[model samples]
Target: MPSSGSYAMVLDSTFSTERRACRFSRILIDGGSSINILYRDTMEKLGIKQGQLQPSRTVFHGIVPGLSCSPIGKVKIDVMFGDKNHFHREPIWFEVVDLDSPYHALLGRPALAKFMEVPHYAYLKMKMPGPKGIITIAGDYQKSLTCAAASSQLDESLFIAEEKRLLDRVVAMASKQSDMPTDPKSAETQGSFQAAKETKKIALDQADPKRFAVVGSHLDNR
Candidate 1:
């Protein structure tokens, strides 16, 4: 194994459906995160829809400070880890988000606690007790980095595309507004008006005279 701090490796692995029919890869094991997250794209890959999600009002932070994220909903699904020989299966609750991310899913503290697993970050491995024996899983560093790099690049490109779309929308709106027929007649008032004996401005704030209210001589102090 490489010496500690020699290299940084993110623990990315795979989780399969209860029956082992489908597998979702590139799942990050984040012990620091308090909640399990399932991205919308993966949720779709799971063949589920937003309408099928159970309602949840819970909000979480730790993304951008001062900003809280509310999940699309919460879902409990049976997931299994490890090979067929020795593995652990359990129902895990995940909060689904519509946002795009580098990984398909994030297995957080909740999953760690449930599985009673210990993860070694430097080695990029996780160990948990199984019914048969101890299951030690390790992720490929090269693949993990490759996936992250590709995902991040795709994310950036998507942002640029969305920015262009927004600019086009704004330009289209401006063109539509310009196309609308307008009468220049509205700017000029039809009749002349006169005010009764005018009075000086009454400064309400002692500090700044600019912040004042006008009181006409015709009106009472009240």
Candidate 2:
């Protein structure tokens, strides 16, 4: 299971369906509720009117599903949600509710029940009660460390390539300094050649590391 940090998401408090975007720190996930809830203040900022709400219900608010969260007053636009690859580009439906205090929105069970069903480390304290049973969940940022594992290999490769390229540049510059003539014309030529060699080495480092390393290892290689 991924840690809470792995799934830690930041929501914009002042988001626009069209223009004038803003972000908020108040975002919560609630498995107990059936529908996602939005605060009146946020809705107003987005230029969404209460009249647009669809007839739906929870203890605090009514449902406005399928219509999409759009900014109507300023410009025609859509509010988007989700992560890099797995995101809901379609305007997500939100219900307008009169929130007393403490939260801007609640991500109800329906919005993230599936992902929650999987085992996960917690970042905060939360509870859930459903047809099967009731479960109390703890939240923590620990899972974020595991997420790093997913990209560890890629990071390692990039680091190695970068390191090798830098090392090759250092070596080439050192060699050029040692081999260059004191004569002005020949010194300029050597410096230019040295710069070109460094550029080629960096490019080769990105495309084919082994070849770059082999060539950098010998005079005949470049």
Candidate 3:
């Protein structure tokens, strides 16, 4: 099971008519999907115009044996992923399959694989070689800005190039899955990795006292 805070985020979008930030939670980190998938409601809520979308292919959930059917459509989303230190940005077209979630969409194999190649040190909680600022979105340490920084350095071209390479690698790696280890150590490794991220966030806040809370009103609700 994934930890409580696993979700896919959108940095921006291209809705010829309407455009807005895209976000969703519980996005399946499936390495099985061929392309990214976005929900219709999400698109509407994000103010993405339909005319801006180009045709694209996608896989839907419920391919499993005994489950209700799922509906997916062809849609497009602009995503930026990496870490606050380093990140990448890309505008990819996708289908809107399996559109029933309060969150909005899913980042399938094609999208999930993009981050799998990063050289993260579970012990240190950082990506190797540091961030590439060219593709990263610039702003204060706001949650959204930080999230964008965390995902990519903000270079759209570089982000897409790196993503394509990772996708190809994962496709090959998928066929060689049996060659990989599914050892129990994987859990321990992931726990350590998450801990490092939390630690880094704390350090960032300490470095910049001006930025404190990311979700202001949401915290009050608690």
Candidate 4:
């Protein structure tokens, strides 16, 4: 087993869009991902116009099985790293997705390859070749933990919202059924009404478990 200090660290960095500079507290430099991704909200906040986005067919899959996300579009933005003297700038293509993550963006394998950088997670740093020399980016352990917690909370909220939406739909359907006229004296009408109630209950029970499973799987992957 590794020592406590030897744990892997989450790396973060500051980047700017065309409009303004932004500091992303939660950036996951993932070597596993083939392409870099930017959250839709972040792109919008950076004043990127919807017309600038080009349609894309790229799909993103999480660690969870059967869970996949599709990007809304793709855009090219200039990304800069390092301090005043040693900073490097490059135009990077990013897939914009509607992801409710704590991270504003994810720098993936492509970005890593572009920078020709090697990440040393144990040391909480990454180094890349620069014009002058090697440039180093450090990770913050405390900030990573805080961001992880916040991301978890956000996931929970989204799950709850989805559940509430399903429940509301079910309730609406029941209310519509109740509004329909039914002759209480007719035995056939009574039987049909009772059957409808049972059907509604069964539908609610079955649909809820599936939806909950999907949400749980997505959360587990994150």
Candidate 5:
């Protein structure tokens, strides 16, 4: 059992995929999620080939409503957790999604249920039945906050880079048009393009960290 003070912590578990062992900083234990998620980049880092994944049609949503995401595919891999003496190993299904998330993988409800583990949020710990009776894993509170902050910063940077890329594409198109004979409706078309750019800017702003605070706070409070 955990005390009240422990609720401020986030539970993270260290596990290995089929190819390699993952760092603790890259694994998040998320009780709120119904499905386990493995980021595409992480899969690449582990040297897992795309051909290994099975086709999947699952779509996911963020903590914020209306923010939907589609996964690339699904894969089954061996996940090993707990310390050496009391470690547990199992084959788990993970939805592979191409997204920039702080954690490389998220262990969701399905994984927990499979292990028959009990998560104590207030203690920032997890326990499950083992051959020896019980196995426990503790969370790193500071690492959780650091991961959250870094993840947020990375998202902002990606957004800025994407916006710049779009603007560059528009400018290149305009430059190409300048070298050729302009159509009679060129001015109207340019105005419409400018309006579209403004709309993209607004969308970028709406994706700021404030919009994702709900999810961040939930992890922080776990």
Candidate 6:
């Protein structure tokens, strides 16, 4: 992989639905992936009802180093490939995940092995056996690279979501720390709030020096 420029190619193609009415584009055939992932949006677009998806508790990682993804469910989608002259339909089980990606579906090792397909990255082609003969899926390099460039947006979205969760946790912890503790010894170890452990009473109005409420001394008079 080149570090500086966007000069990478992939076996990106499209898969047709069982009805052959709709085709899901921006599909990536990745041999490196261990599980086939179907984007939630794509599943919906395919008219796959929620009732069709079976309960799945499988959690997987690798897209993001520190993040793990738990798919909503899994379903077997009849994927139609090749042309009218020689087409093949295969039922592939895909884990439905809620992720923002340029690709609609990711055909992993499981799917590749299921189809007994061979992918040639250099030529941007995928060959698999069909009823009549061998089916070849050609990838458009320019379109693939365009989609690949937008692929990083998914990672950025993931990172943004993760950061929000972390920030929410910190806010919750801060609220916990601000609460009054039953015992002084049991108070949480506070770090950088800069809040005074003890409060003092200050005059609110100079006309009536007694008009005051017990508040943190660090609080602004305004």
Predicted model with the maximum TM-score: 6
Clashing pairs in 4: none
Specify the highest-lDDT model's number. Answer: 6
lDDT of each: 0.74, 0.48, 0.45, 0.73, 0.72, 0.76
* Candidate 1 residue pairs in clash (backbone atoms < 3 Å): none
For every candidate in turn, the CA RMSD to the true structure comes to 9.1, 22.8, 31.2, 18.0, 22.1, 12.3
Residue 57 of model 6: what lDDT? 86
Tens-place lDDT per residue, model 4, 1-222, is 234344335665666776787766667777878989988788877888778899999977862233578888998877766878897667779998877777788888888888887988766688998888988988877766676687668767766877799999999999999886687666566564543232221122554664332232223333
In candidate 2, what are the lDDT values of residues 49-96, reduced to their tens digit? 667656653344222211134222221224334333333323345666
The candidate 5 region of ten consecutive residues with least summed lDDT is 195-204
TM-score of 5: 0.64
Candidate 6 TM-score versus the reference: 0.72
lDDT of 6 at 9: 36
lDDT of 3 at 107: 56
lDDT at 102, model 6: 80
What stretches of model 5 exceed 4 Å from their correct place? 1-24, 63-66, 155-222
What residue pairs clash in candidate 5, if any at all? none
lDDT of candidate 3 at residue 165, scale 0 to 100: 90
Q: How does each model score on TM-score?
A: 0.64, 0.35, 0.38, 0.67, 0.64, 0.72
Better of 2 and 3 by TM-score: 3
Clashes of 1: 0
lDDT of 3 at 178: 71
